[model samples]
Each structure stands twice: as C-alpha cells, then as structure tokens.
Target: MVGEDIDFTRLAVILCKPDAVERNLVDGVLERIAAAGVSVSARTDVVAEPWQVHVAYRDTLTDPGRAPADRPAYLEAAFVGRPVVVALAHGGPDIHARLRRLIGHTDPAQAVTGTIRGDLGSDSIAAATAERRLVRNLVHTSDDPAAARRDLATWFGAGRPAPVCDFENISVVLCKPDAVERGLADDVLERIAAAGATVTNRQQVTVQQWQINVHYWDLLVDADWFPGRDIPACLEAEYAGRQVVVALAHGAPGIHSRLRDLLGHFDPPHAAPGTIRGDLGTDSLTAASAEKRLVRNLVHTSDDPDSARRDFGTWYGARRSGLLAPLLPAQIAPADA
Candidate 1:
C-alpha cells in the first residue's frame, strides 16, 4: 500500500547539500527549481546523518565508478554533521529527468551555462580532486522513478519528514498588504531571523476575499466597535486582490507571544521603537479611520497555537499537509506553564 501511494515518476526528493546551507543558497536554489514548473514543498532542514548520506550516495560509496578511492571521504566531509535542506518536487512523469537536467552536471565546470550548477556553483571537479574531496555542487535530485523511491525512504524517513508540528514553537507570519506593497517583507523577515527564529516557506499570496473574510472574522463580528467603518467593505477593499507574504517561524516555546511583542502595537504609532511595525511602518489606525480603510499595520502574527494552525491553512492552503511537521507529545506542558 505504501508503494501504491508513491507518485513514482511525478515525485523527486531534493537535497540542498551542506554547502548550499553554509552559503545560504537553499532559498535561491529552491526558487530556481520551482521556477522550472516543479511544485516544491515540504521544505525541511536537517543535520546530515551518516547513514542517510550513505544510503543516498550508495552508488559512489559502493562502486565509486570513475570516482577516486577517496570519494567516500569527500562525500562524508561535505555532508556529515552539517545542515542541509530537503524538499519534495512534484511534476509530470518525467520530473526526475527534468530535474536532473535542470541541476546540470556533477562537476560545475562541465555543467551547461543555463543550468543550476553552472550558474550558482563555484566549486569544481578539478578543485575537489586536487583537495581529495567531492565537488560542492549545491544540490541533488533523484535520478529517476526508482531513485526517487529510494530517496523518499532515505531522506524523508520513509516518506515522513522530521519536522514535528511543534505548535508552541511555531507561528505564522502574515506580512499584510502594506508590507508587500511597500517592499518591506524582506526587512520584516530579516528582523525575525535576527531575533533568533528559523523562518521558512516564505510564500506570496494574492488575497482572496473569502480568505480575508475568514481571517478577520472577528472584525466583522464586532463591527459596532468602529461604528462608522463597514468591516466587510474595508476587508474587501484592502485585501481582495492585493499581494502579501506569508512565512513560518520556528523557535522555542512561547514563540507566538514573543513575535506578537516583536510586532509591537497593532497601531504603528503606539508601538515601541524596536518592534517591526514601530520601526518600519508609516501608516497608523488614526489615518485609516479617517480614510475609511483598514490600518496598514505592516504585518500580523498568530496570537496562539490554534491561531497559528488556522493562519497556516488560511495562507499556505490547507491541502499542503505534507509541509507540516509531526506533532510532539500532547502530554508535555508549555514551557511557561
């Protein structure tokens, strides 16, 4: 049954090697891969385990092919104990071949000018051979359906990845319309990372009315608080076709409130100096009220665990369940508790 469930030709496992992580090219590489029409998702960061890499490079480790006798050591030095990014790429039946071609040759020097390795890779076969090491090619993709099947088992723990749900440790970042419009999403994310959060899966979504309606359902329900403003109309006018950036932030427990505090006040003018909105935002609630629109607060973060889960669905799409990490023990108490 597990074999029956595999997408075979349509699915490939992507391994952004330690060098990619060290150089912070995971996002850029993944973006290029995704740009090639493959659906990239289930992104995860893992410290390379010897066995995992052994299984992944079984061909070289066992047979070496044209590789030198020191090839296994080179592979180990490049991957073991270092961090790498893993993801799933979904496409047509020829996805494996497509991705293989897209990544280019094993040696960056020999890779074609238009390919991923050719463009982004700096290390070469000659350099690696001289150093008695493997070339730092940046990424790896399954060779074909059969390889994809083995890779699924090898890297993804038999199709289930290692990221646990970790609600208390995760929060959703919603860079509101204003943030994207003003080109401040990157700055906002940078600040979040600086504050020691692991932010991933940054996505751009063109707001749908239904999504905004549900996201701010409370505003609609409590419209009377702002007697003159029409909540529904405000939501539609502000968000309905606008673009926003969404991301997942992972950290220690209490990440939700920590992020909320980091965002400062909902009304930028009232926020503290170091907070995200306080430092970057120009618009305020008073201005919005006068203009009959929603306050351009720059960003919104989930208020709690349940809110995070809902916000994940609202922005990232509910059906992409593979992206969520596994859940930790339910009996464990929150850190503050």
Candidate 2:
C-alpha cells in the first residue's frame, strides 16, 4: 500500500489488538479467517505506540458516538506499549465485509453467535463505558480501501526485510488430533524433547480444511491410494474442527529427518518398540484398512527442510511470523553517532 499500488479489493489489513496477544488468540483467530477463503500473510509483531494508535483511530477516537467519552485518555492507556500482531489478508473484493461479519459486532456482548468476537470475545461495550474504557474487542479490519492504505502504514510500518526461511536445523511437529483427543500431546512432545532436540512454541490449533489440505497435499494428489472414499470428505471428517498440537523442534542440520525417524512408521504395529508410535500410538493400518479410513498415527514430523517450512505455515498460520524469531539471524545494528 505504501510503496506499491495495492489492489484494495483483494487485500485487507488485519490488526490483532493487544487483547488478542494477551489472550493468546491470534493463531486461532487467523486460522478462522483463512478457513473462510482469505489468505493471511506477512504477520508482523509490533509494539503499539500512542501516535500509531492515534493515527489508526483518527476517524473515530475523538467521536463519542463510536468510542468511549474519555477515549483520548483511555486509548493510549489501552494500547500503548502493548504488543499487537498485524498482517495482510488477501481475498476477494468483499473480504473487508466478510471479515467484519466474521469478527462480529464492535461490542462483544452484542456480537451474535458464530462470529469471531461473538464466539471468542468477553468484554462488552456497556461494561467498557461504565468503566470509562475502550471495549476489548479482539480484532479490527480496514473499513475499506482507504482505511486499508492507512492501516497498512500505521500497523505494518516499513515492510519487514525478508525473513530467513531456513529449515535445515528445524522441523515442525504435529501431534495429530488422535494424540490430542487421547491426551497424549504432552507425552509425544516429551519424547521429541527427550530425543535431544529442543521443542518449543507448542500451540493448539483448531483444524481448518485449508490446513489439512496443504499439509496433506500429497494425499490429495495421490487420491488413488484410498478407493471408495471422497478424499476431501474423509479429511474434513477426520480433522476439521478437531484440535491438534504443534511445536517446533530445533537442533543441528537434518533435524527434520531425525524427528521423522523418532516418530516411527505410521502404523503402530510396524513401528519398533523404541519409536514414538510403537511406544505410545494405539491405532493401526490394519484397522484403518478394514474400516476404510486412514491410519491414526499419533504424530507427524516434517519429512525434510522444505516440508518443515510447509508444516510450519500450515499449522501456525501465516500471521504468526514471530514464531521464527529464534531462527532469524540477528540484525547488525549500525553504531550510534
């Protein structure tokens, strides 16, 4: 929006406010947006500044009809110094409207069911007004193309330098829904950590169709392997709406292959006693074959460096660029005058 002419109809700026970061809802929130056909990217973590917030709310902050009567005083108190996550959501021209509906009413209490604010928000406008504060709604999207341009400037700031997307020493570990439902996520991650790799940033994700599709792209490509089953339907039935745990495993180069070996064969029966599947998994290929379903492996690790990047994006959401902070090379700051 700043350097190039952006197609506002196809792009919207998403601001996950401080409340979202504090409540740890940014990942799940972005996942829901993506599930609705929007593609989120370039998620940048930023600390809110008073001037930025003032600029972002220039049109409304001073209006009592839209904001608290004491907005000038409370706005900064609510946002300044707090961490916020911003990203670009790309979709059809209607994306702004769709996202607004998805996020629901400005007041969480008035927000109807099924919308993001309705389902996830807890604060109410009435309560905020009574307390002389701003409502703690979880997110905000550009009102229109004009606002998109301003939001892009206010939130995203200068484009982040391209991130170091290396994966030779990193792997994404997905504890499948089975493991989560069976209460084995901790056990599975512990095993990976026990294997001498550092495990961190563990997050729980509500399955979205796009995520399953992308992560299992090969399955869709080679659907011939499963006869008499609608691959998409089977995938939705198996994963959509289910919760899974994902984490990062870091070590020396080739950590991806090491983790895959640690996870063992997909079939529990075929996995050796020392492997994660052999030791903890309960489902088997034999049962799945007979039942016309896929095997329920307890966990999956990236197959290679490339797959690690794919897996990371699939489970973590594109807006979670901060998760790669550790993997990024330190910026060399110029000496002060």
Q: What's each prediction's TM-score?
A: 0.73, 0.52
Give per-residue CA lDDT, model 2, range 122-176, as digits (tens): 8998998888888999999989878876787677554433245468877999998
Candidate maximizing lDDT: 1
lDDT of 1 by residue, 14-70 (tens): 999988899999999999998787767667788888899888998887774665677
Report clash pairs, candidate 1.
163-325, 164-326, 165-326
Off by over 4 Å in 2: 1-47, 61-71, 83-93, 108-110, 118-133, 144-157, 160-255, 265-275, 283-302, 305-337
Per-model C-alpha lDDT, please?
Answer: 0.82, 0.80
Q: RMSD of model 2, in Å?
A: 8.3
Worst window of 10 by summed lDDT in candidate 2: 326-335
